[model samples]
Target: MEKDKWDKKITYPDLYLQFGSEERSFFKEEAKHLKAKYDELGSFCELKKFTGGHDYIKWNEEFVKTISKLLKT
Candidate 1:
């Protein structure tokens, strides 16, 4: 097996199995903004919300639901 470009080094192309393009982009942009904010603030702990926090969590829960649905299909 090969290492991934990102940290945690999961198998390449495997993340796509868990996310669609838009979902992946959303995560990427969120992470990017978090990094930039961290750099400016001199700390990386504050995860500024790009979207509403509750909505984001709810959406993720739905995403898990979708995954479950897909698995059941």
Candidate 2:
């Protein structure tokens, strides 16, 4: 029998969650939980924790890198 899109046996698209290492404790914990859930569902996920806080300057670099990799242009 063919499996439906919503079936547990189906794998979803890639997921990327990037956060600041110096972010708030609670937010970090939340991110951990979210990543765990996606992992449990057999999804391709990536969690990148940088050495900076919730600053745009640090996030911009990582964002550009990730986008470049995805675009592959």
Candidate 3:
């Protein structure tokens, strides 16, 4: 079966119950926001790698690092 066709078997609630109601709600909200952001980013898919000129090596490296940092956030 395709991965996308599969339902989520369980959720955060089914895990440890030490979380209070507020914490659980916050976790769900944050998860929703992150999911929306990733979907938005996925919609702007890149077609191909942008190869850089030799002279732009430093600039390209810095650009990649910045993108990585942004993704982490």
Candidate 4:
């Protein structure tokens, strides 16, 4: 992870975080916390929670959504 470099005064880009409701509580909580931190850091962050689990299928769907958003930017 590049987290070590995050505090180096580098410009941060906007981010999107997609998670599944069916994922473990710990996972969801962690994502939410990270989203909050990013939001406080003045980053455009979107956290989407969908009805699925932490599996490849959900990841694929999120990937598609992310790509679409990127294209719109």
Candidate 5:
């Protein structure tokens, strides 16, 4: 979705996205689009790219890192 199409009246929470470099093209494009939209809207958004694929183990590690970072904020 485009940034202009987003509802400005509704508040959006901070976005934290974790994606693998070896992930599918479609998913990566979607994440990039979302990040672009958030950037255009001037909202807080983070996108972390890892050198891996769609694996649960990596996701679990990223999840822990995300949680830890969130906790520190």
Candidate 6:
């Protein structure tokens, strides 16, 4: 991975992330890194954690919530 690409300061669209409580450790770490990167770039980023694992039911619920948030914004 290119360090400059990852560290570049540029405009970015709003980000909304949904993670499950039982998600893999690697995924959680990646999410945290992304949040930090977005923050460093002065972009809007939200990370929401739910009490569930990687499944369709949880995904469906989070999808609806994400849509609602986007619509409201």
Best-matching candidate per lDDT: 5
Candidate 6 CA-lDDT value: 0.81
Candidate 4, poorest ten consecutive residues by summed lDDT: 1-10
Q: What is the C-alpha lDDT of each candidate?
A: 0.45, 0.79, 0.39, 0.78, 0.85, 0.81
The local distance difference test score of model 3 is 0.39
lDDT of 4 by residue, 1-73 (tens): 2353344255468777888889999889878877776776777778888888898888888889899978999
- Residue lDDT tens for model 3, 1-73: 1223322442322111111233345654544554544344443222212333323564466567656966799
* Tens digit per residue, CA lDDT, model 6, 1-73: 1253654656888888878889998778777887888898888889888898777799788889899968898
Worst 10 residues of 1 by lDDT: 11-20
Give the better candidate number (1 or 6) by TM-score: 6
- lDDT tens per residue, model 2, 1-73: 1232344687777877788989998768867876776787888888999997898988899989998999996
The regions of model 2 sitting more than 4 angstroms off are 1-12
**What are the root-mean-square deviations of the candidates from the true structure over C-alphas?**
12.6, 6.4, 17.5, 3.2, 2.1, 2.2
Evaluated with TM-score, which candidate comes out highest? 5
Q: What is the lDDT for 52 in model 6?
A: 82
Cα deviation at 37, candidate 3, in Å, is 0.0
The superposed Cα distance between candidate 1 and the true structure at residue 36, in angstroms, equals 0.3
Error of 1 at 58 (Å): 22
Q: What is the C-alpha lDDT profile of model 5 across 11-32, one tens digit per residue?
A: 5789999889999998798889
Q: Is candidate 3 or candidate 6 better by TM-score?
A: 6
Q: Whole-model lDDT, candidate 4?
A: 0.78
Candidate 4 displacement at residue 27 in angstroms: 1.0
